[model samples]
Target: MKTLQIVFIALMTIFTLNAEATEYHVSVNGNDNNKGTAAEPFKTISAAAKIARAGDIITVHDGIYRERVNPIYGGANHLNRIVYQAAPGEKVTIKGSEIITNWKKEKGSVWKVVIPNSFFKAYNPYSDVLMGDWFNKKGMDHHTGEVFINGKSLYEKSNLNDVIESKPYEEALDQEASTHTWYSEVDANNTTIYANFQKFNPNKELVEINARESCFYPDQPGINYITVRGFTMNQAATQWSAPTAEQVGLIGTHWSKGWIIENNIVSNSKSVGITLGKDRSTGHNVWMYNPKKGGATHYNEVVFKALQIGWSKEIIGSHIVRNNVIFDCEQAGIVGSLGGIFSEISNNHIYDIWTKRIFRGAEIAGLKFHAPIDMLIKNNQIHNTGRGIWLDWMTQGTRVTGNLIYDNTTDDIHVEVNHGPYLVDNNIFLSELAIRDWSQGGAYAHNLIAGKIEVRHSTGRNTAYFLPHSTKVAGVSEIYCGDNRFFNNIFIKDENGEESEQEKENQSYGLHGYKIAKYANISSGNSYLNGAKPQEGETNFVEKTNLKPTIKITKKDHHVFLEMDLDPSIFNVSTSIITTELLGATFISEAVFENPDGTPYVLDTDFLGNERDKNKPSPGPFENLKKGLTLYNVGK
Candidate 1:
């Protein structure tokens, strides 16, 4: 009778809390002083966020909100969480930039603007130079500030003279827009900017500049179970998101868990777009401050330090970042370190990342993560970035599946220094270099590799690997290079004489690069075409020298299509369904390739969610794919 009474009281309390939950509204035409109702809404999102409790809803109506929304509180749990969403069929843009109209003509195509330092209050992004561990300034200074004209971002110049006498940058992807540059000078009293607007008049046109560090991010950590949905968040002056530092993005979940960021257009961040990363207390730019110790050593120490201070699954990670369009970021489209463990990143279109090529670093990519233990990255279309997906450090039990990647300047996927039981399956790798394998113990299945694969041993640096589906460090070991299993993959070589001189010199095309590997490797049922080579000591393989399949990606309206000329006879090769039992375990980590929840993964479905043949599965991402110039509508 006593136990039943206790349970009843708990149930009643939950019901009361749900009954009392309120819905607050925010609109541009509304006043903060009014009651946050549909008729009288709040003026800013920050106002509603302050008083919102668990199970509360904050609905923002259509309009541009030009302020940082710092949520003071998070929900108690995932069941009863705080939701900040745009009104249905309405467009709401949250920005870290403010419109600037004051301008003076400095030269024929140059315009100048001077503003009081009081306008920025405490934090001025113009003076905040981008710096962190593993970030190379490239002998030039770059700030976290930006100048925009009519929503188009202008390139940053180092000096006022460069802005005045602007010339097209030879290395820029779009050289014509490079001439429109901006340079800033900040002092104790005022901030001044000189910009080469070219033909546009700054006073007459819509001009904006970076005013804040982040658009929507909590100042402190432990803000958990918050949902940010259906808002166009852009143009934030975010800083460099290094693995050793507190990564602040345009919209970030700083060291938190259970955040669902979906259905929004995120773009034009000064550095990173979305960050689900660590906080400053664990270790902030320790490598930059202490160079005597190597980066790998520092990161290992940081991991232990993080574990000591609540880095478990209960407190950090498990973020859901899906169905968002992210582009035009300099550093990474999505970045995280240890705090990205057990998260799901899916169906996001990330492109045009690091295209400016102004600053070089080891951390630039479409999606970059460190210590992503049991993370699921699936169905994302990443292209035209520096690297497609960079899974660095302790990438244990992670799965990369159903992703369409192409046109990346660097490799499609770079698995660096990880003794992994990680799995890469059903992926389309279309780049000059598909895989840059610096670590070991990976399984690649049903992938269409149309580029060279570079394999190397990280003998000098030893990296950590964790227990299965957990953050507990199991062991640390230097990479022996090839404890990898490759099965049912399609390898193709470019028949056209378009190979770079360096690629020809290295001879990195196909599995031939794995010849010099130090450890054990396996390859079976892999098909090679158009002079692509097979690995040494492999028996089960297919080859076609005369078949040259031309693969290209074409965009029509909002849809992206993969146009490829494939022969249906290629499916005649024998292949079986991949499973955890066949994958075995990594030598160092002793972890098996399984799902994030420790469930067995049977590769029974194709990339398009079609069931594979039970007896003999087809190779590549598709099952029984058609021949002769077929087009696959890869959703953007």
Candidate 2:
């Protein structure tokens, strides 16, 4: 009975170990011959990722790993989703080595310059003393200003004196060194000093950087959905070659999708930190052509309407991008212009964007929607950029609401050739200026615009343009400039305090309109309050004299009618009168007349002529009339 109980316990222990998920441990000091368990671990992350399967987690132990590890090739298998995570209370740092090389010493130079390794411990005051102590205990001199590693220099020649002065080598050997801690000056020089180190965790600071060519993958489509989390990648500035047709940080392909990059710090790269390819057709015609149509002669000119749904048919909708922090890149951060739809970009802080010499402009918006449909850009803070939000041609049904934009060098929100009904509401634009050309159909309501809103015509100058002539028709028009109810909007000119009475009087005489009508809503608070009063004009009437008959009416039963055509050009005409009269006579039937060309005209009686004599008749029996006229003439 005792032996059976012991056997049951042994079986239970083995089953518990087998049921647990696989955990591959990685450490800088581990040996290659050891297993990837915690007790026996591998040294490099590249090796650990090679043997990991899907749903497997790679636990990285604390230490600075001074080599680059490519995780893309091993991460290509769909069943092998690799996760590189750090252990609790342990910081796994992947950075450059901190040794000096290429020493050139000359007389009267005041100091010798040497290039340091990418990740040197001398940048931090606390870590510098430890590094100095390690060198001093090895019988090396403490007066040396710098150290070289792998034939590369770390500190500049001008910074050698500051580096020597800031060293705590002598104080580190004293008995009172434990009570005092050193702090460096915070300035641009300090930023440059920190830039030399590949990674620096200044007690409470989070360090993130990326090395060039550290991640590699083949150009294929089956390798989708790669995720990277909780890492600081320090990329060398001059090491990264220009991006070819087949290269990227997370995944390398001309066309690839379903990548998840989050919770990582990346900096200092040539092309981009995270890039998704938009241009295909480099190496093979297979990926270039549409595969679902069974090789039906793919033409590059044919563009697909929806890319995200066509690329990954398993997902019922488009993908989601959220919760990422990207900073200090060579190009626009998070550029996904590869024909995607229904994507959400929220809660991301993208700033400090720099451009190359070839490209002219820079962009640092929290979210940029470039020709995307059914997109939502909300609840983001974008500031100190070139342009806050930019929309190019054919952007439809996009809702830009609840965003706070300020302090940008250019416009806050810019849109062009957009046919969709944009709902721009509740957006607070504080100290922002926008110069937009045209808007066909949209609603700009409930927005708190503190600055000037300038809408100009695209084809002409900055003067106010009129609405088109065809807007008064009965069909549905594209522009709905109604219900936009502006209330409590204040406009302060430059001469608000110093406004003269003469300038006020000149402004009171408003603009004249001949072919177009104008609507002026001047408030009581304006300076032109008592300039012009509204007046009603007098209506003139006319009596017609000579009328023309349409046909010769000789029979007694035939009805005789007089048709008189009055001229409206003789009246005092104005735009307000014309607009009111045209609107009032839209439904009257008998007063309407049509010209020979079938165009409608109005019969106003202001210009008809009167007859000279009313007693004259045509071909009357004139014997009694002539005798009366003769007697009257003789008596007179």
Candidate 3:
């Protein structure tokens, strides 16, 4: 009788899967009236999305699609996913801009174009300045709208003089088209844009305006179990997505679960690129969370609302964002709020993330995530960015490992107010200010960190850790910025290293006030090379040094490079690698990453996806990552 029941369940599963599986096709030259078949493809992706069900597949052909795709439904699970793919080996470009060709010449290298108010019927990004909760405008108003000429995003100029005087080449960041500036004026009936093309003929080149709010975003929530693959989504006039607001991006998985966004080139946004964040909600009580009459309340209200709106393990985020080339944004390449729980972000190459130095905000980085409960960031190469990874509040059971990060304007990893049991390991951090810690209860091991290290504790600011496999918030108290461990790592300060960059400004590197918090942070068995100095007057660090380690160092293309060639038999870390005495918190030992519930989440994997020796793992990301391993260059 039990065997019969088992057979009945298997049959039911097969029947349900087969009932849901279907295929759809989309093309630029097709018609919306046609059925979404290979020979009779739909014209718009939105049309196919309206009819697609769970376990369906939508294959888009090679062409430029000039519309936004708002998917309403995600499939049930991984096996029953709603897959959206570019036709195999075909190029797909989805743009949020419309081609505007009716430009009349006004002055030298300046052109004027008038678009009717009715043209932007529902939305006009030009009228929307970058304003939101917790946003620092820097006393100037930057708009969400943008103008692009010949596939490059032009700068937004206030006046014709600002356009003529704009020197993009002299800009500090390596920008593609910053020299081309534009200005917009909106009246009751029409909107006008004055642009500087800088001697380029506007009649010959392709010019476009911000016609859509987002490139490939769903306006509604709970779009889950969707896989978007092999496309180039760009040129959106997206607004700022603070946690308090509805976090939208060029392509966002807003408040979704089990989504896989892979193998796409997502670029050219006024704000964020890809966002895995919460829906509109009242965020925690922090810097700007409250205003006199109209501001938000405290952290307990935020947590209570999360509970009210289903903050369980099944409802919140568990998305997979991997292998995508995301770049060229004023804000972040990727960002997430409470919706980044139980997620894996790996193998994505992110670069050139910040160009707006005139505006200052706490929400800009290559990747910025708030409340990353058990989130995994691995094997991703992030460079030429403003800051690499900013893991803010509620960062318990998080692991940042097996990744390559460098060429950032600020620190590679910056952890703010939290009582963490987080781990940082096996990373190549070649930045000027790597590992800027403001929180504590972290264990650092087997990393190659290069920069000034600093930590700060606060009495007013605080964060929370959680109970495992759940959102039952625990360890909720004032900020504890201590109980950290540093072991078996490499710190380099060659003349060819970070000191060269600091000396370019005649500035000094390394910790300036590190000895004050010596008891809070601990260290051991670390190697220092080329005058790389640790915090002076700190006697708590076990086996610390400042001289060159017994290793080879070389330079190629203005970057300092080094590797360990010692015998494997001689490579062993002490059993006192980590303990309750080292980290001022309780921990369970696992050969791999375990969740708060003692369930195995990840185990013994290197940056190259190679297995680490469970018994005696080597120091650093590569067990044997040699040959064509380019660390750095003049241009990345």
Candidate 4:
């Protein structure tokens, strides 16, 4: 029995050693020498992260940690996947901690310090009171007027600005504000404060003021499927002397893929909030940069590009962008894609974007795809932007449907490319606006296109202005108006009785050869006007051309059928062509002409021979064509 007991004890000891788990605890007041247990924890999160393995959790206790910690694992390919979670109800703050070594005092009705030219290249002039007001409005703490020079209070000196202006190394720190109050000015002499604030001290470090590095890094590669969550990134000051691209915060490059940045507060950056590269050719990827870019800069020029994707390459497959709130960015709130394929961007709220010029209002485009293919943009609310949604530069085969666009300064939805099989349907453009260069081969069917439909060439020259050229051009080569179809739509005019007749004429400007059928149900109150008084309760039929060709039915069978061989030249005739063959009683339900491989044949000028002269109508073989006729239908 005693020998059995000894064997059992040895087995139990080996099992315990093999199955044991390790936990690392970090506390603000704990020492680094401690064992990192629940009762005795490490002092810093960085220390714990250094020793943590793949399946480790580092629990942080509640307190303000003023140290800037780079929690990147050298061994692990993914940097942010390592979670740094805090205990419940314990708020851990990571911010810049500036310890004042000396102080100085200055006397003035308006507390001012003249920074010497030797310290910085330029200076920003704004009173502390003004800054206080801005901070209060933004829900930040305020500062007072007492000046300190390196933690020691300064004596009230006469002409203090002059002293600082002459001295390069001189530092003036404000002590009139609370001990915790810290602010730095942008001037020559304040370079010391700037350097001092940014100084990194591992021993008793202050919170990191610049959290820009926490967002993203461009140089890294193969960083796919990583998520960074639950953190606040403070703004980093911009180096105005440097180029715009070099300005700080979360920059990405071509190789970056499958990254998800969510539930983070980013503010007060010099340039854009988040910047994405032009890497569209990278397939099967999903990347998102969301929420705020935190902090305040001296330049009112501060703007946020909350999310930027694809300025260079085409991104494809399983891309999703939704539910992000972006505001008060300088250039554009969200700028996406000059061109790409198979991408979906929807349900993002963008507002308060400002630009420098008058014609350039707060430009916020819901989805700006230049020459995109096979894309779908639906169910987004875009309002109060300079141009709500713009599709420029040969956008093809894309669908902009089911989005609610209102209160935009310019056209709600603008499509510039003229070569496309794109579909713009089921979208609500609350304002009656103009869509330019819509002569592309596609269907604008089942949509409430309430605004004035204006069609023009590239130079803003209305298609109506080219009437003389329309006559001279042979055979309506690319019937700018015809090849497309618009059916089952509603057009509403301005209810305020303000639009003019010429404007209305401009609205319904280009309707030469386009087929607008089944529009009899269009409401009378929805007036169509140009640059004239609002035509009240006027309903106009879309004039159909006599050149529309009809398909005749001939015979039908179970698996084989036949129809009249209608040549393409039949389109040039000015009268609707109709033929009644032997009524085979086998009625033709629907007849459509398709290419050999099954795509619908597009009828353009190439398909139709040529346009007849305006003075003389083109002669047709009406009497000769009546000789032989055939119509057939083949089905399963």
TM-scores across all candidates?
A: 0.97, 0.45, 0.86, 0.43
Quantify all predictions' global Cα lDDT against the true fold: 0.90, 0.35, 0.73, 0.36
Candidate 1 vs candidate 4: the TM-score winner is: 1
Across 1-636, the per-residue lDDT of candidate 2 in tens digits comes to 999999999777555544554888988878867899899889987787666654567888888665545444323333344556767667665543232223233222222322233333234221221110001122321111222222222222223343344333332222222111112222323322222222222222332222223333334434444555566543322111111122243322223434445555554432244444333433123322334632212211112322322432232112344455555443334443332233445545454443211122222232343334445555444454445666543344455554555555455676543433344543544333532323333333223343334332232211111111111112212221111112111122212122246433212111111002111211111111112111111122111222111111121333221121212222121111111123221110111112212243221211111121222211111111221112111100
Worst 10 residues of 3 by lDDT: 627-636
Query: TM-score ranking from best to worst?
Result: 1, 3, 2, 4
In model 3, which residue pairs have backbone atoms overlapping below 3 Å? Answer: none
In model 2, the runs with Cα more than 4 Å from the true position are 1-21, 31-34, 61-82, 86-222, 234-255, 277-279, 282-320, 355-376, 391-401, 416-418, 421-427, 434-448, 451-636
Name the regions of candidate 3 deviating beyond 4 angstroms: 1-14, 167-172, 281-290, 293-300, 494-514, 533-618, 624-636
* Candidate No. with top TM-score: 1
How many collisions per candidate? Answer: 0, 20, 0, 68
Segments in model 1 whose C-alpha atoms lie over 4 Å from true places: 1-14, 497-507
lDDT of 4 by residue, 384-403 (tens): 54556766433444566556
Q: Which tens-of-lDDT digit does each residue in 59-110 have in candidate 1?
A: 9999999999988889877777899999999999999999999799998999
The parts of candidate 4 lying over 4 Å away from their true place are 1-217, 220-222, 228-255, 260-276, 279-318, 338-341, 355-366, 432-445, 459-485, 497-636
